[model samples]
Target: MRVEQIYTGCLAQGAYYIVSNGEAAIIDPLREVKPYIELLEKDGVKLKYIFETHFHADFVSGHIDLSAETGAPIIYGPNAAPEFDCIVAEDNQVFELGAVKIKVLHTPGHTMESTTYLLIDENGKDHAIFSGDTLFLGDVGRPDLAQKAASMTQEQLAGHLYDSLMTKIMPLADDVIVYPAHGAGSACGKNMMKETVDTLGNQKKVNYALNQPNKEAFVAAVTDGLLPPPAYFGANVAMNKKGYRNVDEVINQGMTALSPEEFETAAESTGALILDTRSNGEFAKEFIPQSVNIGINGDFAPWVGAMIGDVNQPLLLITDKGMEEEVVIRLSRVGFDNVLGYLKGGIEAWKTAGKETDQVDRISAEEFKERLKVGESVVYDVRKESEYEAEHVEEAYSRPLASINDWIKDINPKEHFFVHCAGGYRSMIAASILQARGYRNFTEIEGGFKAIAETGVPKTDFVCQSKVMKA
Candidate 1:
């Protein structure tokens, strides 16, 4: 038996491939199904199942398309109300895959339909548990995401999660492997461990959610400090529940190469947002005016979902050469399927055609600190509220990137505000959005707060976040 955790770093999501004898099963796949198909073909295995742990909110799952292409039935846990055809397996039901068995453990905490799959090896010993969002290595899934769908408050869901972990999960053997759906950097859980796989015994000892002595303690622990789910999360969940355009069709429509003029005309006609997926440094140097930058190299997909706020927003791409297809695929992963096309020859083509371009001034963190010392600049710490409260420059404003749309209005556009995130990734994103909205006179700190902290700038640590609010 072979189990492979196909981890996508951008989404911090893990899709599992389980194979035994000549049969294979996929658990919680990404929107792009081509890679899974190729793997199956290469191994000469018959695709037996597409297992969905839950209707995910973060990225569009490939179950529908994978099933359609391979004739494999999509399986869900009880209470799943997907519009499409699927087998809703009951609790404790076991499915045979060649020499091994996968038992469904209906652990509905993350979502009403959330389930964990227990793999029993050919020897009939429980080998591993694919703990989908129900249990992360260091945390349990946040219960708030399913509050609306389950008609239960986050506290109630947390209670259920506690029961699921105690009854179904914690009873497993010490050596049983725990494969979680998401790792650190995912919003699915508050405190996921950086490691993707851990032994169940280790989790029981270290994971706060699992170590809770009572349901009340568990609920309070799990529900605390959840930031609002990204705006596009619900839409992605809807698409996953209903169904969506085939991955191939979406790619074909989006990967069209258009000349600079054609790209601009399509943007005008379609009112598509131009998304530049180049590196932060390159995008800061030059880009089409108003094109938002979420670099392909960083945490691209989740940031796209968080910032764009619309799954169906039509987008045109200005990607580095040979990156157009990748940008489209990543966009589709977050349910942004309405990509119009891409700039044919990238920004160089636009400049060659004498098109007006825009650039944002970027400075090293040291230079930003010098400016701060001279009282020549205002700092806008665009990291999350939690990050700012943890540590920030003494006078930096607490403008989070997640709520940039609302906060952008409160600040004067003409004022010079220096922006930074933990590192440079999110600050550049903030800078581009500000630029698109006609906010100039700002500089992006090259190394963000990490570098700023190193520069001996006056800094403060807040005992409570509310104390540091910037007006």
Candidate 2:
């Protein structure tokens, strides 16, 4: 028997592949299905099942497409009513895959249909549990995401989550491996550890939610400090519940290459937003006027979902020449399938054609310090509130990048200021958005706070996050 955790770092998501005796099962796949198919073909195994932990909100799952291709049944836990055909397995029901068995444990609480799949090896010994969003290595899934769908308050869902963990999960043996769906960087759970896999015993000791003395404490702990879900989350969930365009069709449509003039004309005709997916430094140096930059090298997909907010927003791409398809695929992962095309020869072609370009004013941290020594300068720290609270440049205002759309109107265009994130990526993104909106009175610090911290700038000691949030 072989169990593999296919971890995608960008999403911090894990999909599982388990095979035993020429039969295999996939758990919570990504939007792209070709890789899984190739792996199956190479292994000479028939895909017997596609298991969905829940209708995911972060990225569209490939269950529908994978099932269509492999003729494997898409299995869900009880109370799931997806638009497509699938077998809704009851709690405790077990399915055979060649020499092994996978038992369904209807855990719920992350979502009504959330489940954990327990793998029993050919020797009839419990091997591992693919503990979807229901349980992370150091945290439990946030219960707020399913409030609207389940018609339960976050507290109520947290209660269910407590019961589910106490009963369905905690009873497992200490040696049983726990494979979670997401890790530290994911928005699915706030306190997830960096490690993707852990033994159940270690989780019981280290995970806060698992050690709660009672359901009340568990509910309060789990529901605390949840930021609002990203704007595109519900739409992604809808696309997953109903169906979505085949990834191949989306990719093929997005692969259309257009000359500079054609790209300009298409943008005008379709009113598509131009998304530049180059590195932060390159994008800051020069880009098409009014184009938004969310660099492909960073947390590209989730940032796109958070900043763009609308999946149906038509987008034209300005990517590094060979990265067009990758940008499209990442966009598709977050359910942004309306990609019009890409700039044929990238920004170089546009510039060669005498197109007007824009650039953000950037300064090294040392330069910023020299300027600060000369006089008072407005500075905006675009890091998370928690990071800002931990330690930030004294007098830097907390206007997190995620909440930029809400707080941007407060920025006085005439006032010159400095902007920075942890390592300049988000600050550049913020700078581009600011420029697109005609706000040009800001300089982005070259290396963000990481650089600023090294320049002997006056920084505040640890403070309460509430103060930062209020700012």
Candidate 3:
């Protein structure tokens, strides 16, 4: 028997592939299906089932598309009512996968239909549990995301999560490997470990959610400090439940490569937003005017979901030459399938075609420090609330990039502001959005707060302990 965790860094999501005796089962797949199909063909195994832990909110799952392509039935845990055809397996039901068995543990807290799949090897010993968002290495899934759908408060869901962990999961064997759906960078859980796989024994010892003394305590701990989920999350969940455009069709439609003239024409005709997926540093040097940059190298998909605000916002991409397809695929992963095309020769072609380009003013940390010393610049700390509370510039205003839309209204576009994130990635994203929205008088700190902290610029560790706890 072979079990593989296919981890996608951008989403910090994991999809599992389990194979035994020419049969295969996939767990919580991403939107793209060709890779899984190729793996199945290469292994000489048929896809027997597509197991969904829950209707995902971060990225559209490939279950519907994969099932349609491979004739594999989609499986969900009890209480799931997807609009499409699926088998809603009862708690403790077992499904055979050639020489092995997979048992469904209806651990519903992350969502009403959230489940963990226990894999019993051919020897009939429990080997691993694909503990979806129900359990992570150092944390449990945040209970707030599914509140509207479940008609339950986050505290109530946390109660259910506590029960699910204690009754359904904690009783598993010490040596059983725990494979979770997401890792540290995911918004699905707070304080997840960087490691994707861990032994159940280790988790019991280290995971805070697993060690809670009582149900009330567990609910309080799990429901604490959850930032509002990204704007596109609800839409992605709906697409997952009701089915969406075939990924192949989406890819075909988005992979069109338009020359500079053609790309400009399409933008003028369609009113599509230009998304430049180049790195933050390179993007700061040159880019299409009005293009928003969310570097493909960082938390690309989640930031795209958070900043774009609309799942179906039409887009035209300006990508590095070889990364066009990757840009398209990652956009599709987050249900952004209306990408018109990529700029064929990239930003260089735009320059050659005499099209206007804009550059974000990025100053070195030293320059920023000098400016601040002169008492001429207003600084904006665009990192999260916690990061700001931990340690920040002595006078910078907190304007987290995640909720930029709301806070942006408070800033006067006419005044100059210096923006920075933990590093440069998020600051550029904020800069791009500001640029697109006609806020031009801003300079992004080249290395963000990481570099600023090193320059000995006046800093403070003013922890608003109570306010931090409330956030």
Candidate 4:
């Protein structure tokens, strides 16, 4: 028997492939299904089932497409009513895959249909549990995401999660391997461990949610600090539940290459947003006048989902020559399938064709410090609020990039300022958006706060001070 965790770093998501005796089962696949099909063909195994932990909100799962191609039944736990055909297995029901058995444990808290699949080896010994969002290595899934769908408050959902972990999960043996769906960088859970796989015993010892004394404590702890879910999350969930356009078709439509003239014409006619997916540095140097930059090298998909917010927004691409398909695929992962096409020869072609371009005024951190020494300068820190609260430049205002749309309106267009993220990736995204929206009186720090610190800039670290007073 072979069990492989196919981890995608960008999404911090894990899809599992398990095979035993020429039979295979896939768990929580990504939107792209070709690679999965190739793996099945190479292994000479028939795909017996596609298992979904829940209807995911972060990215569209490939269950529908994979099942359509391979004729494998898509398996879900009880209370799931997806638009497509699938086997809604009851709690404790087991399915045979050749020489091994996969038992369904209906652990529903992350979502009503959330489940963990227990793999029993040919020897009838429990091997591993593919604990979906129900349990992460250091944290359980956030309960807030399913509030609207389940008609339960986050506290109520957290109660269910506590029960799910206590009864369905904590009872497993210490040696049983735990494979979670997401890791640290995912928005699915707060405080997830970087490691994707861990032994159940280790989790029981270290995971906070698992060690809670009671359901009330568990609910309070889990729901304490959840930020609002990204705007595109609901749309992605809808697509996963109803069904979406075939990924192949989406790719084909997005891969259309257009000359600079044709690209301009299409953008004007369709009112598509121009998305430039180049390196941050390159994008900062020069790009089409109004194109928004969410560099492909960073947290591209999630950032796009957060910043753009509309899954059906028509987008035209400006990517490096060989990166067109990749940008399209990543966009599709977050359910942004209305890609019009790409700039045929990239920005170089646009420039060569005498099209106008724009550049952000970026200065090195040392230069920023020198300017600060000379006079007071407004600075905006684009890091998360937690990071900003921990430590930041003494007077830097926290304007987290994720909340740009909300706070941008308050930024006085005439007042000049400097913007920076931890290492400049997010600032570039902010710069692009600012420029696209016609606000240009700002400079972006070259290396962000990390560089600014090295230049001897005075910083403020948050300190909790309490004083005792006597009457």
Candidate 5:
């Protein structure tokens, strides 16, 4: 038996391709099924089975498309999967595909239908178990998503999660390698290791979720620090159930470039919005002037999905060559595919053609501090609540970038707000949001809060995340 791990970095999602005796099975596929199709062709393996650990809440899944393309039956656990036709896989059910025998284990907690697949390799020995969301390298997925607020309290779901971890998943052998559906940088779990893989034995010793002395502590740990899911989460899940439109065919139909004058006509003709994936500095200094500034450097995918509601529409790229194809592919991973094409040489090409350009002023942290010393400008530390609690600027008031727009609307729009986050990425996001919301007088403090601390700005014990030392 051969096992291959497929990683999608942007989403920190992992899917597996297992081949035995010329038969292939894919577990937890993303929206674009082309990669799996190509892998099968190259390896000369026939597609046999497709399985989803649970109906995902974050991204639109490719299970239906894989089932349709491969003619392989799509399987989910006994707990109901919404939106698609599927075989309800049973616990302890053994299914053979080529030389591999797969035993399904029902492990609910991440979601009601989450499952673990135990694979017996050709040598007739137990191998890895694909523990989707139930367990991770060092953490477990938050139980708050399906258990919505005010209805099923966080404590109730945490109890269910405690049971799932203790009784269902912990019984597996120590040697069994654990393959989790998600890794670090994923919102699915709070403390996933940066590594993509781990073993049951290692996680047993280190994973805080399982290391808890009892269910109460375990429940408390997993129920916190969940960043809100992208605004488009519900829409993507809805689309996944009804079966999303074909992104490949939509790409094949083709799109054309247009002058600013022709842009309106193209928008009328093709119905695609021009997406500007540039830094707030670049977007602010100058632009095509009509595109939406959703930079590729930050959390670009989910926001793009949220802003561009229709996946079938054409996407005009307003990014430099360094960021173009990547921006397109990231969008594609989330099932957006109406890419007409990018500006040939980016905005510079259009500008050289005598087209108009737009501009906004961006300032460094040093300059903002100098201004602050003179009492001319103010700083808005735009980070998340958890992030603010972790660490931030000394004098700058913390306002999470996610909700900065709503926070400052009642105040001055031209308030000399200098923003920052854990790193510079979120400051860029805050800068863009301010730009989009017509707050042009703001400046993005360079290097975020880190820069302020580096300058010897006095801060508090809460300024840096030192509690991990206790852990």
Candidate 6:
């Protein structure tokens, strides 16, 4: 038996490719099916089963397309009662893909339809479970997803999750490896770990959620104000229930290169978002002020997603040629097909074309300090509430990026908008978000709040060399 973990990185989702003998099965497939196809073929396996632990609320799954193209049977938890190419899996139902034994456990906490796939390895001695959302390495799925499609309440879901983790997941052998459907930065769960996989025993010892003494505490821990799963949750669930359309096989699917003027014109007309996937410092130096800064560095997809909650709009990208395919593929995996195209030749193309550019205005720490001495510049720090309370620029008004939509509700949109994140990536994102809302006088800290400290600029609210909670 062979098992492969596919991390979509968009929403930090984990999909699995499992095969035994010459048959293969996919669990929690992302929309881009090419990777799965490649893996199965490499293993000399035929795609026979496509199982979703539940109807995903985060990103659209490729199950529909995979099923349509491969003539594979689509499987979901019994409660999904889904209409197409259907197989409703039941608890304890055993199946096989050659020498491996597969068992399904109905664990409906994250959603009414969530399930865990327990697999007995080819040797019949090895045991592993795909604990899909119901259990995680350190945390569990967010309890708030059941707003309406739920047959379960928050308490009910949390209770179910607690039972699933303790009763079903915990009973597996100590050495049995555990694979989850999500990792950190996913709104599906509050405190997901970064590890793609973990052993049941390691989780039993180190996982905070699993370590809780009772069901109530576990439920309380996992359910507490877990950030709302992306605004796209409802759309994704509906797409999954009805079944995904075969996007890759859909005709005329290749992306085009967009000229500066053509792209800018499209932006003006259709309100497309221009994403600059350069480093935070590079973006702050000068960029089309209209662009959102989501660097091509660490944790690209989720951060890009954190900035833009809506994928329905066209994504016009500005990046080095090296990152074009990556950016496109990441978005495609998450079902972000609204990408109109990428810049024909990145920012240099616009420069060569002599097209006008806009820059997000920035102020150095010293310069800002000097201005504030006589009150010329009012620094509005755009960090999270938790970050603000811990330590921040003395006079800066705090409005977190998470709450930016409602930031200007109290202050008029015409008010000076000076936004800053730790290193300016988020501030640039915030500034352009304001730009989109017709706020003209927006400025961002050049190197972010950290730039001031690092550059020997004046700062009154000095962080006292203590570790901060990584929120």
RMSD of each: 2.6, 2.0, 2.0, 3.6, 3.4, 3.4
lDDT of 5 by residue, 316-352 (tens): 7777666665676677666676687667667877777
Q: Write the per-residue lDDT of candidate 1 for residues 1-471, one digit (tens) a residue.
A: 999999999999999999999999999999999999999999999999999999999989999999999999999998898999999999999999999999999998889999999999999999999988999988888899999889999898888888888999999999999999999889887777799999999998998777777888888778777888889999999999999999999999998999988998998898999999999999888999988999999999999999998988999998989888988999999999999899899999999999999888999988886777435568888887867887888877899898898889888776777889988989999999988888888889998888888998888864564333211
| Tens-digit lDDT track of model 2 for 1-471 | 999999999999999999999999999999999999999999999999999999999999999999999999999999899999999999999999999999999998999899999999999999999999999999999899999999999999998888899999999999999999999889998878889999999999998888888899898888887888899999999998999999999999999999999999999999899999999899888999999999999899999999999999999999997999999999999999999999999999999999999898999999999888424789999998888888999888999899999999999988999999999999999999999999999899999999999999999886765344312
Task: Flag clash pairs in model 4.
Answer: none
Best by TM-score: 2
Please list all clashing residue pairs in model 3, or write none if there are none. Answer: none
Candidate 4: C-alpha lDDT:
0.92
After superposing candidate 6 on the true structure, give the runs of residues whose Cα lies further than 4 Å from its correct spot. Answer: 249-254, 285-289, 298-300, 303-307, 364-378, 386-391, 412-418, 440-442, 449-471
Task: Kindly report which residue pairs in candidate 2 clash with one another.
Answer: none
- Give the Cα-based TM-score of candidate 6 against the true structure: 0.87
Candidate 6 displacement at residue 275 in angstroms: 3.6
Model 1 stretches with alpha carbons more than 4 Å out: 374-377, 461-471
True-structure lDDT of candidate 2:
0.93
lDDT of 1: 0.90
- Model 5 lDDT-worst window of ten: 462-471
Compose the digit string of candidate 3's lDDT tens values, residues 231-296.
999999999999999988888888998999999999999999999999999999998888999999
TM-score of each: 0.96, 0.97, 0.96, 0.97, 0.88, 0.87
* lDDT winner: 2
Q: Considering only N, C-alpha and C atoms within 3 Å, which residue pairs clash in candidate 6? A: 142-188
lDDT tens per residue, model 6, 1-471? 778888866468888888787998888888777777788777888987888888877777888888877888887775777767688988888778778887888888888788898888877775788878787777777766864777567888888778877778877789999889988767676656778888989888987788888888877766665554555566667777875546653212325678888878878888778888887667656667578777777456655555676757677888877677777766665556677777888888888888767666777756655555424446677765546656676667888776676666666655565567777767766776676566767667777777666654445664432123223
Q: On TM-score, who's better, 3 or 6?
A: 3
Q: Which structure is stronger by TM-score: 1 or 4?
A: 4
**Model 1's TM-score against the true structure:** 0.96
Error of 6 at 236 (Å): 2.1
Candidate lDDT (C-alpha), each = 0.90, 0.93, 0.91, 0.92, 0.72, 0.73
